[model samples]
Target chain A: MKLIVSVKRVIDYNIKVRVKADNTGVDLANVKMALNPFCEIAVEEAIRLKEAGVASEVVVVSIGPTAVQEQLRTALALGADRAIHVETDELPEPLNVAKLLAKVIEAEQPGLVILGKQSIDSDNNQVGQMLAALAGRPQGTFASEVKVEGGKVLVTREVDGGLRTLSLDLPAIVTTDLRLNEPRYAKLPDIMKAKRKPLDVKTPADLGVELKQHITQLKVETPAQREAGIKVDSVDALIDKLKNEAKVI
Target chain B: MNILLDSIEKVVGSQNVLRGEDVRSRTADWMTKEPCLAGAIVRPANTEQLSEVMALCYEANQAVVTHGGLTGLVRGGMASSDELVISLERMTQIESIDCVSGTMTVQAGAPLQSVQEAADQAEMQFNLDLGARGSCTIGGNIATNAGGIRVIRYGMMRDLVLGVEAVLADGTVVNSMNTMLKNNAGYDLKQLFIGSEGTLGIVTRAVLKLHPQLTATNTALVACEDFNSLTGLLQHARKSLGGELCAFEVMWSSYYSLLTTESNRHTPPISSDAPYYVLIESLGAEQKESHERFEKAIESAFEKGLLIDAVLASSDHQREKLWAIREDVEGLAHLLAPRFAFDISLPILEMDKYVRKLQSAVSQRWKNAKVIVFGHLGDGNLHVSVATGDASDETREAVESLVYEPLKLMGGSVSAEHGIGLKKRKYLNLSRTPAEIALMQTLKIALDPRGLLNRNKVLPDILA
Candidate 1:
């Protein structure tokens, strides 16, 4: 069985990000970029399946600017067999990216397709479900556990109450949760080899999908300033302030 | 074999199958646990069937291991051959992103980056971050109480989580997805799983608090002549930068030089020869004002003789290069063979003396052993690496004792950001008191009566 994993490039969450002055968006001129955390988990899960010999080949794909190919390279380094980069300078919206990814999925025709639940930069959780809908496949979202039995996929989902389990047919979309698998670091050797791996670069024109930006940024501004409160002399005074002023008691 | 396979098939259906060698990969975590290893791996799709699966496992006395994004430094998720591996790879979904409430409710398997992004999309920020944010699950972060660079400004994973839902050892679902920031109703059951490292129960979902996104950030690389100067700079930055002071990371000369060596990508910001270097950052609403204040703070420190030399990041590229010096620990990792990485915390006042004493002790014992130190100094946390000339059982024990023994007297902790996995299990007592240790064991037993979840971790062995 073949597995296709979708990943995205995002700002490293550890570094505090600031929106640009023009109110356009976050300043990404020289920001430290990385693979979206959930997407990395998705990639790790796919690679693990391949390593276990359950999956024949792991193919990674991403829809973004040419720069996103770096994230795909990272996935390849982590043990993906090849990658597909849907090159677009502008990330139009969740639905557009999903549409592009669905096209890639149809072409690859992998047994399983995995995606991060959301992207760190956009936090749009619609892509995976949208891809599932576009692909006309059942989705196992927020999966905590996944097992392949006979010809069906059993997925354990982390839900409001607890873990919920379900079964889906083959050729399904599974969005990875954090607990899926610990992603392994790409060793130096693997990083070198990933450069030589097959990377198929496609464009919106090639996919025959029209890119559309659904959301427009009216203004991007920082949160209101948090004033420095008076330092209490003692615990009793602190409690009084918390109760009276902050009312966080 | 058919009976076991048949039982699993009853819950997940015929297609979800794993047997024999396929089970080995899921059996053990990084630390390698024995008894709770997976005899099979059952992947259930939703909560109801997972409950049924857990019920079956509990009835059969078969230990079940819940797996999420496995980037945990600790072995809390490791399974054994007699157990079953229940992976959450399919349950990754963002249930909701509440903009008004400033919260995001997500499945336990959702990656930390995914939650952070969801918060970002809502024009809010999830303050919980770490090096493993790309691969680690929010559940694992909660389980480990993960702390990253932002711990100084936003606190740890414990501070970010409003509520959680987890499955007990017996597969009983405990849902406590509280969205309110101030919910003091009862025991705060979410606390039980927040830092327990997945031993008590398997966390499946969480409601995490979010903050408004910052608009501006100012970063700098400064050189300190001594520990006193470092402390002085920290105080001045805290007072002058006001609430905007977000990060104050320190790097020893040894660490800085190692990064700036010929083969490395980073060039020394100042000289790579200072006794100590600090990477300071401030995030605020006004970039112009924050930059002005940052400049003034450094100017004041320089006048007061607290700083010898300082370089403000003029451009984003320069700023990144400066940070690369601090974040690149791989240089030190390469230089040292058989290195033991230690993350510890001590009171700010006691840190200098403690480091000196530990260095002297290590030198006396090993002669050629090198100790490199650096960390988030603002939060009193330090990451120490001891590269030994020889790797032996006795050498390891001696090095550990020398490094950890001083921490006890200085009222410091053995494991700071990193949880006490198998590596630091024996040294737990160096930090926690006997009464605290006893209470921890009691909680472990009370919650996991069968000792099935992440056994023999985070706590020391009981004395006879």
Candidate 2:
């Protein structure tokens, strides 16, 4: 069995993001970028499956411009057997990304596909479900734990209230959550070896996927600075202040 | 000391004064973990309270040892059974940050890590960093004139500190807290207390200079087959990275292999086959351009045969892993216990020959001795640890001779950044001339007349 993991490059969590003066979007000119934290979890899950002998290979895939290859190579260093780069300049929507992933899935025919629940850059948690719909396969979203045995993958998912267990048939899609697994540091020798790993790049047109934009971002602004709260001597003062100042009563 | 404890308790409050087991419960230093042998531990709330306590001690002629984080390796904070300990643990307040002047005003007891974090929160860098930052205090850093990984770029703690407020032996508070860069009006009085090891005066507060926070940091672990290439690479990096180059740490093969062996926790990032591994770090203003420049510089170095192999950290996580291998001082301590650790510095050109000569001398004395060397090579400092199976006083003395004797001829220092504390006080003459020692004595006698402050620590005792 083979496993396919999808990753995305996003702004590093350490960076203090700055919004453009025009309020159109966040500035990304010279900011540090890394594999999305959630995508790292997805890559860790796929690599763990391969290490456990449940899967024979782990192939990582990413879609973006040339910079995305850096993240793909990072995934390869973290124990992915190979990498595939779906090269495109424009940022693609969830449906288009799902279409591109479905094309790669058709060609590779992996037994399992793991993806982050959402990319941190967009926070639109629909790619896994859309890919499942396009590929016609079962999906376990927001998976905390995954166990594969006898041609079936048991996924324990984190739901609104508690964990929900689902048994997906062979050749299923599992979207990783925060609690899936912690990623390991790439070893020195492994990193050297990753440079030699096969990374095949193909254009989005080669995958029969056309980029489309459906949503228009109007403006992006930083949240307003919260005003300091005042102290009240008693509950009566609090009630009176809330009613008069806040005007909520 | 007992006569002064009453007045000390009155000034700092009784609960702030600890005695017997309350005092011994604390460790003497960061490394030894020995029971503190002070008569009483006094925790003053602020600089004024500490001044009052020091006044009482001075009147009684009581010997006192100033404690700041207790992380010094040279037994600088060690106190005897009859002496009192004036611990700065409670005087840790960050007064304010003047962004316009680019300075942070902090109490002496503020931990180095807190100061660094505070500066970072203000979008500024403190510039002084070390392995013991979490426990070491600003006062101690100032007292020792601490130098760490970035000294090559940012200068030492003496350069980082703009001014200091200290209390003298007779409890005279000298508040020379000048926050300007160019204050040459008269004698820079703060220099007297900066690296005196708490022997002249106790630093109560300091105004530290801060630099703009770095946006991009590029780190790489490169291998050099020979010492010449290592020095060559350092010069090349200095020429290429210029002011942006912050740290250039080198680990000898013995140090690297021992810490990164298969059984060790760190997997060797680069094969431990090379004679030297240099951890090169550069910090810059722009991320994209700095990264491109770093890559180009490294590629050119490789092409010029200055480095045999290299691994550039692709992400922040990878960068930390590479640093972990370099900062594995604990791993070295555990592996080479009963070791005599020496922090010495010389001309960079003499380091290779010095280490080789010291290694042969150590092995000749003890056949099974393991001599491990690694440090901030860019700053001309190397931390050499030698273990010959026994930690006896005779063995320590023998090893110390093997390490310090050669440094005398090379015009090197016995104590590089650690200072001439109790451990290296005997060998102070090796690093300083007779006139320098006499002048140091004159200053010590002038400042601390009764020798009540950190007695017999940094300066040697005057013979009767």
**lDDT per residue as tens, model 1, B340-378:** 778899999888888788788888877888888999999
Candidate 2 error regions (>4 Å): A1-5, A14-29, A37-60, A64-69, A72-96, A106-126, A138-249
Candidate models: Cα lDDT each: 0.80, 0.90
Pairs of residues at least 3 apart in sequence or in different chains that clash in candidate 2: none
Model 2 per-residue lDDT tens digits across residues B217-293: 98889999899999999999999986789999999999889888834769776688899999999999998778777
> What is each candidate's DockQ, to 2 decimals?
0.01, 0.25
Worst 10 residues of 1 chain B by lDDT: B27-36
Q: What CAPRI class is candidate 1?
A: incorrect
> What RMSD, rounded to one decimal, does every model reach?
21.6, 5.1
Candidate 1 wrong stretches, greater than 4 Å: A1-249, B1-6, B13-38, B262-265, B461-464
